[model samples]
Target: MENTIFSLIPPFLAIIMVVLTRRVLLSLGVGIVSASLLLANFSLTGTVSIIYDAVKGIFVSEGSLNTSNIYILLFLIILGIITSFITISGGSRAFGEWAITRVKSRVGAQIVTIFLGIIIFIDDYFNALAVGQISRPITDRQKVSRAKLAYLIDSTSAPICVVSPVSSWGASIIALIGTILATHNITEYSAFSAFIQIVPMNLYVWATLAMVFIVALRNIEIGPMKIHERRAVKEGLVSDPNKPAVDKLQEDLPTSKKGSVGDLVWPIIALIVGVVGTMFWTGIVGSEGNVSLLAVFENTDVNTSLIIGGLLGLAVTIGFFIRQVLVYKSVDKSVFKKGVWAGTKSMLPAVYILLFAWTIADLIGRLETGKYLAGVVEIINLNHSFLPLILFVIACVMAFSTGTSWGSFGILLPIAGDIAAATDISLLLPALAAVLAGAVFGDHCSPISDTTILSATGAGCNLIDHVMTQLPYAVISALIACFGFLVIGFTGSTTLALLTIVVLLILFVIITSRRTKEV
Candidate 1:
């Protein structure tokens, strides 16, 4: 019943198993069962009881299946519905067509790809698949390598989502941070506060995003990316065999209406406005009209606001879909129901995955894994200045191995928060930021990451080629992030750290460029 070194085994073992088998669900199940066994003191009956208790805890427990988490789940469901509506209505195809006509050059094509990648800030999987599928044709016509496009899609997908405040990634991050804080009985802080504060410290995400634009705007390439670009331009070979051609995920039904760009644009804008507005509205309402906007944000429930936004977006999408159907008469009325049902069905699996993640994370807490890991940190007694970089590296390694940033977050954040609180509370945001940034960095380059695979699939390139070509660029951004974290860890000045990273990246790009290819 006491916290011990063994408490850490389940998380680490799960990570190892994930790395070896590339099986997230199995790995997570194994972790939960293993922890349950240990908590049962290795008794089979006791372990079963533990599992039962955990299941009960998720739904019946007071806080585990509470309002906040429920809303978060609802938000995801609505998000899926919106995405399905977009695809089945032919909104995606219409937008892609509209976008390509304005692209007068290769740079313009790549820029549009990057722009689309950045703005798609919903889910990483969606971002990758959408950007890659939509932009690939334009890139191919412009002679840009599928590898480059994959890199663009892969890099932008996670990086943008992880930073976007209204995204699924943001919800996951908030939920994780909040759960950890609650477990620690740290009521003085808010997850939203931490989420907002940590943004500046998330150097890897910023660096990765910046690197994509740098690559796009500067017309340069490095390492294998350079060679791939050369091959594409000179040989007119766009696809790379190293990349696996993953079949496009089928929509509920083909669209007959041929949706306009406005169809895609309007829903997303409504979603964004809804999310932002509801956040403030909830914040103000929670504070009883006696707090600043920041205070309200730090006090309001993000899960509720996000759910509201998602629902609002869904309503807007439904309205638009009906209007289009009335005007164009393109698709049958039955198509709408099928699209909604399909979207809802697609998200159920993901929602279940999140629940499983929550269960395992709870198991870790029950096992006192955080205290065990924090004890080890205390034993090392490393300088607080080194903690950010150390935590960043650890997070990156965990995420890279598991190919699941969410898992890495669930495992590391509570422990990191524990270590920081027990050592110096000031390091809390930095530690969280480090873990978030590192997890994203690892997920970006990980061969097994869903986003990475989807990027390759969407671009119709070999998966391995995307991985290999993107590696150098990912490493460069990571290295820069590492240095920036180190500086910020020591000085506590994000401005200086960001400035240093900017200079370093500019120099690297300028020094590394041989001759810019037309592609």
Candidate 2:
């Protein structure tokens, strides 16, 4: 009993610290330290040994910087470099300028912004920054609140990427599913197969997308976000208090080189082509020449594909530089360095977050906390007929605590997958869907979530401000998803269940819009 209680201490403390401090790194550090202290308390060697071991385990253990985490971090850095290059070369600005010319109304601008976010569907981190940067000017020009812009960016980032077949998120989910399948002795099951099976069942992903469209089209305003939206309409985009006034001056100054639609369109095309080509070559061509696309995804790993895509992005950047230099009859070294610096700097925060998340996961695993937690979950009634709802809540809680959808999925997939297999449940679809939905729920709501922070940063909104404003909508969506899962679990009709939620959510948004108008 005492040991069980001690085991729960770290996670509880971690949650409290995050809620109190709202600093992810600090919260993670506190969680790790608390876990170490608890482990020491349980062990004969006491607190010092536990602390030393935890620190040493991170640096010295092979498990600490394993292949998957290393690959993810490397990909993040590469993506950062690529994005930075694009931004420095004025691609993002060009896109924004082009969007402003094309979009006629504030509503149209918001819809287009959300549409572009949906189309990107590559990486959430990339989506968050890229969409925010590209659309910020357009949203600003239209008098849309920065908070609303951040919400749009945040809404699309994880939700769309998680559901897309040709993205980093797709790759991670597939890999996790594959791990689950292999662990459960299901050799016939594949990641892509599992992904397709679960995609329809991913209530939160579909519902969130539905909510985005409904909110945009109906112009629904609720909670703290409603207040911010009204305020921004009255006063204009709020400047960041932390940034220097000089930065504001630079942003306000007029530009000599205005970007055209072609400048924006071609690069985006090139990026999409590169990503698709790489995935096709690696997933389709490399396998049996005639396998289905879904089969290929199940069989192939997307990390390698993304690396290829990054190289392709580099090539495209080089081509753009050449074209510019030749067209102008001049070359500037400063421009090249500027692109590199921008990409590197933009990616630094993600890199740091990844490293810290990895270290914390490793530390927790070493202390056997995750395993023990897994056992405790199994020991409970989490595997019953209503297991789907249990899994949903568990996933949401884990993800909320961890501040990462990916990490939450990583932790819960195996446990949920195994339980699903043992119970003769069609575990592949619902289990995977539950984890995915839960991760998004947590990612959406957690104040410390990296994507949430990135959304705020990209939109130039306050971090806490974004969190407070966004929470109510996220809660509503999560509750709806939870109810949807319950219906699916009982009736085994995922499509109907999701459709019902969609209709209900749409109605809710329309009604809310009317209510706001009346108020």
Candidate 3:
């Protein structure tokens, strides 16, 4: 009992700090440090040697910097630089101006922005920053609250990316599925094949997107978000005093020739075309007698797909800069440098968040407790005839604590899959869905989650504010998902369960909105 309690103390203390103080970095640091100290307690050595071994073990045997993780960070950095360049070149401003002209009302602007976010579908990081920057001015002009704008951008980012087949997210999911198949000794399942099979079962991603549309179109209100929306409507446009005065300088300049919409549209198109064409050329697409895309993805030492995508985005952004310069006939080298510098600066926070999350995740992996945790989960027979709602809750908690959906899936799936093998339950779909949904739930809500932080930063809301405001909505949806999973677990009809949840959520939102108005 003492050992068990001691083993659990670090994660518990971390949560307490996060909730009480809302300092994500501090919480993560404390958890990692405490875990390291606990690990040192087991080793018989001098203080320095014990500390050295703990830190070394973290990045070596446990969570060493692998090619895959390196690639993810590389993609993030390159994408950040490209996004920064686009913003500096006046592309975002041009897009904002064009969007404002088309959107006559606040609701229309919000809906259109969400639609645009759906269409991007290249990468979540790209989608978040580009959409937020392009739509911020337009939404502000329409008297829409920054909180609402942030919510829309955040909602659309991960959900859309997870579902789309041609994205960085898609690539990651494919890799994970491949690992699953290999571990199961299944030779017939390919990444693309598995992806197609799992797509329909990804209820959480689809459900979240559906909710965003319902809220935007029907003007639904719930929790803190509803309060923020009401305040925005009643107070009109409350100018952010914290915004730098340099922002005002852009107001007086004549709109660029490409326009804000043009700025946003062209670069996105280039990125899509480049990624698709490159993937096809490299045999990622099914072609006759050619190497399989999966083979290429696996064999390549670098994350070639993301590298290719980033390079393409960069080229298109450069073209936009040239076009602006030539059209205005007042371009200089300094202008280009300024754009690049601005883009890089905007991405700094995202870079910091990613690095910290990566380090913390690595630290967690080092603890022998992680393996013990996995063993405990397996021993519980959680996959066998368990209550779906309880399983959902457990999955969420595990994913949240670990800060990784893929890792959580790896741990849970085999155990869950074994249960499926033994019972009447069709383990493939439900188990996979549970893993995906739980990971997304944790990813969406956890303050230390890189994706969550990016969403907040991209939306330009205070980090804590975004986390606090978004929590209620995420929880409501998760509860709905939990109940839906229960229904599916009993009936084994996921489609029916999903449809039922959608309809009920829609009705609930409508009733809630009406009640708030009456009050």
Candidate 4:
């Protein structure tokens, strides 16, 4: 099972169960047990040990605490608390009212979310959570579904970061490219330059971004997203009432009549400033000497920065809570404890889901699911012209199965480099670009993906609803990207491939808008 077809069973089982049951934790739990069983060869004690070690590993790795995972979980709680106070201070309500007057239309609300998502391209995690906080109130006021908002956040977060050279994703990829270039004895182009060149080659990013804007502007809700839009438009329910959401705890919280938009805007500003400041600080501190922008991003501790930012945001929110109760006298002092608890409680679901996801992802890694998939790709003798397309599909499967785009990058990028170097060195960048695109595509579709979970959490959407609704759009963009990769593989023309993708995307938007009911 470690490096064979059997390794694929656990993740697929979990994913299929999630689609069928619409229960994220249960599905992930089942997947975890299944993976442990497979890894233990059906032995009860071995299975238990494997499960224990995997769960334990989430917090402790190699005798030290897994600060990254722990910090991320803490940040979510802090974000939740901040959200609670923001709502209690009437910031959310006030912002919604203000946005209603200014935005005026559903399309405008969606566009604002997309724009924010694109602008905050430093890290996908920050973009997903922060943009959701800023855009959710506006989208809610405009009757936009949480699922659609999640789609916008998810699509924008990774797709934008993957292409931006100054982003954490770009930094990691450049570092990997540097190592791969060195290993293959290829030095014609520096890693940074190669990364810049491949930016245009990541067709999925452009396709997904185009699809997001087109869907927003044209009011095209494809597949299950249509149902969500219909519900939001007709019934005024942004989220599914029957499902559990990350923001559900704030539903009944008291709000102040005296609250102003500054209550919301100021804390978010602090969060952004704190996080970016910390990112720079960490990156500079971690670097050996003479640092550049890319070095800062590459060396920055994202989870630590997030927690520090979350703390700053939380403090600012608490100050607002105090002002509402003390200065304005609009909110009751008695609501303080209740509001804090509710806010903290709201993020518990996201935390539990992340914990389970991390556990299952660990087990899947132990099974070598991605390695097996890569091995299968390596054995297949195909024409060099098809290598880019083949790598794209394989990378998609690997990232989807493993539920981590970074993990896919670590596993498949070197393999892609080696294969391209052996067959046709000229195809190296194209092949690498395919892997990057495929990994993001796969990450978008995976239920266990942290970015997917964070997007849904940030939007206050049901996890399953987010996953199901975004599937068709992700698939559409991926299909377009696949065609682009096919074109790139054969013709080696990034320009022609991009042109084909843009043309197909426009046709898709036109056809879908004509057929679908407008929200």
Candidate 5:
């Protein structure tokens, strides 16, 4: 089954089960077991060994600690603690009350969340969690559903990073492009220049961003998202009460009446500073003294930076927590232990989901799923003009199946370059751009995607609910982007493609608005 059509079964099974059952962990477990069985040829003992090795690999790879995964998990735990402390200190409550006076409308709240997500484009992980902590209070106060907030965060994080030259995503993609360019002996453009050129050609990023803004500004709601939004507005039920949320706090925690917005604002600011500072330090140290901007980004240790920053944020939050109990005397000192336990417990759901997700993703890699998809792309004898569109679709399937955009990029970008170079070197950048766009599009829609998981965690939304609610919007954006890629493929005119996106989005928003009002 490895590296063949059978390699596709595990992911499809996981996706189908999750959609039908809305049970994330159970579905992932089934996928994991099925994948292990396939790899082991249905031998129970061999399957056990494969599963054990895959699980072990998540924490221990190449006889060393998998610091990337460990650090990200640690960051989530620390972030959950900080969120709990913020609430217990009354920072969330105070901030929401404060913002209600200023924001005044649900649309204003959602727009603020959208803009914050766009502005924090350094890394998707940081963007998703940090933006949620900052914007959740205001959005909740305005009765905006957690699902919508998760959608906003997920939509902006990847799309912005994919396009921005300064982001981690850009650095990774540029490095890949550099290798691809070198392999093809294409000397007309540098990787940095190619990345810039490819930016406009990434029509999905544009289409997604357009839809994000239009949805915020026009109050457009579609599919499951509409149901969520309607419930939030009419009943003030921002989340499904029966569902478990990664960011859900314990009930009846003691809150300090004296807590101010500064308690919340300062900790988050410290977090950002600490994270960006650590990124620079790690980048410079790794660069061996040649610390150019792109070089810094390329060499930066993202997971390590996240944990260091998370620690700083946690420290500040603890300080505020102590102040609430010790100084203000509004919160009981006895609540300290419960607060800590509550915070840790809140994040366990997300952690368990991530662990399973990582395990299955690793097992899927062992199945050579991406390699099979890339092979399919390479063997297709399509027209040169259709290369971008074809690569986009293949990348979507590959990333969706593997549940990782970077994995798709690692496997597909080089193949795309090879195909485009042999057929039409001029289409190389567009083709690569299409891969980037499609990978993100797939990541957005995949329930098993880490970014998708973290987005729901950060927003305090149900995981499956976030996946289902955001699917319709992601599909619409992808369809528009598909058309854009087709236009760019044949006409090689980004302006024309962008114009089409704008016109289509306008029609979509108008149509959605009328339908929403009628409902």
Candidate 6:
């Protein structure tokens, strides 16, 4: 069966279903079954076979057994364990009690959340759960909307990870770049050099971060976000208290009498230190004396390194809990195993959604959705000036439809790379950079995105509310990024273009601030 534009029906159908019914799981299920039907040539029996095969592959064979999946599973379990242990030890409660005093205003609480997000930049998952556990209670007390808290949490998660070179996200990106470059036999640029070059060109990421700060700092709310904020302020409703919260682990573990700031602070610090240190050790041992940080990332097995680091962090949490029980006699030693089990159970929903989302993404690839999209560019004779902008838009639309940034990167990077190879080789970095930026932008808006799910879970917000409230801000930042990209496309100067984005971002803040006052 030939893959055509019709291959795109599944994702669109999924998005529409989610919009109409607000049922993410059902929407995704429909997407998978419908897409399977298409792949099976519309035979009902064939669709059943396709579904069974996909389930087996994801759970029984390739998907679960793959190195990347193993690492992620291990990391998730350890993360669950660490968060549960710390929360049960009363660290989360103590931190909230301590933070509430200093963070008296909503702006103060948001700034604290932003800083907490930046400080824990090793992995987006770590940042999402840790920041959410620690910040939600404080934000709630300050009457900040769950949507607003979710927006801050979501923005910082993937965007922060993407920018930081020492992160798991960076490792995946570098590996992808290396694989594509090797496969294409392109020697004009080294992966390391190219990745470094691509960072500055990633406009959507930096712009999104800037938007988060501006929104938090100046108290600018528009669209659905405005309604939420106004409701929070006027009615004293921070979020839907009735909604099922993602912070169940925080409650299930049960707080202890020996609550203190040290309980929360040390465990998080240990996790950071353990992950970074282990990553370095793994890289050094693998590199055989290649000490450059990026070299270690390039040489190191990312899955193995993260799992080891997560284990070390888990060990630290266990040790802290045991000592707390012995010293303070205020903690329960019994909660340890049950807490870990409960935490692991909580992540199953997220895990299933991730697997299904991956399945949809795979189907999209087999169907050549990106190729169909890339063909649009192939026909047009775009010059250098319009090329980056066009590539950015394609990447955005493709990524938005698919609801996965890395998947979009996997599909679009190679095509964009090919386009660059055929045209001016200088377009290589910019083209790749454009894909990275636009993918993150689109993922920001996607309800089914794994990062978005984690963000909602971490912040204890309704997922639909998070998606609705954050979309406007994401669009504004993306529009600004598009403008900056156009400036770069025309002038071929990254500095000037970046400056233009910053200037526009500042102007947007000022204008919105004045508008809010007037209203």
Better of 1 and 2 by lDDT: 1
Q: Which candidate is the best by lDDT?
A: 4
Q: What order do candidates take by lDDT, descending?
A: 4, 5, 6, 1, 2, 3
> Candidate 3 — which residues are off by over 4 angstroms?
1-12, 42-88, 120-138, 160-200, 227-264, 275-304, 322-338, 368-387, 425-428
Q: In candidate 6, what are the lDDT values of residues 153-208, reduced to their tens digit?
A: 98988888877777767877887888778877888788777788889999988898
Global lDDT of each candidate: 0.74, 0.67, 0.63, 0.93, 0.91, 0.79
Q: Residues 219-257, candidate 3, lDDT per residue (tens digit)?
A: 776666665676677877423445321112222223344
Task: In model 6, state the lDDT of residue 402.
Answer: 79
TM-score of 3: 0.79
Q: What does the lDDT read for residue 73 in candidate 3?
A: 54
Prediction 2 global C-alpha lDDT: 0.67
**Can you write out model 2's per-residue Cα lDDT over 74-157, one digit (the tens) per residue?**
555555555454444455577666667778677887897898789877667657755765677678777777778888889998
Range of the 10 consecutive residues with the lowest summed lDDT in candidate 2: 245-254
Which portions of model 1 miss their true places by more than 4 Å?
1-5, 63-65, 103-202, 215-252, 381-388, 391-476, 485-500, 503-519
Cα lDDT of model 1 overall?
0.74
Residue pairs clashing, model 1: 242-462, 243-461, 243-462, 243-463, 244-462, 244-463
| Candidate 5 stretches greater than 4 Å from native | none
Residue-level lDDT of model 4, residues 1-519, one tens digit each, is 798899999999999999999889999999999999999999999999999999999999999999999999999989988999999999999999999999999999999999999999999999999999999999999999999999999999999999998888999999999999999988799999999999999999999999999989988877788889999999998888888886568458888988999999999999999999999999999887889998999999999999998899899999999998889999888988888798889999999999999999999999999999988778999899899999999999988888899999899999999999889998999999999999999998999999999999999999999999999989999999999999999999999999999899988967776676442
Backbone clashes in candidate 1 total 6
TM-score against truth, every candidate: 0.68, 0.76, 0.79, 0.98, 0.98, 0.89
- Tens digits of per-residue lDDT, candidate 1, 323-361, equal 767877877787877887777775664455556656776
Q: Report the poorest 10 consecutive residues by lDDT, candidate 6.
A: 243-252
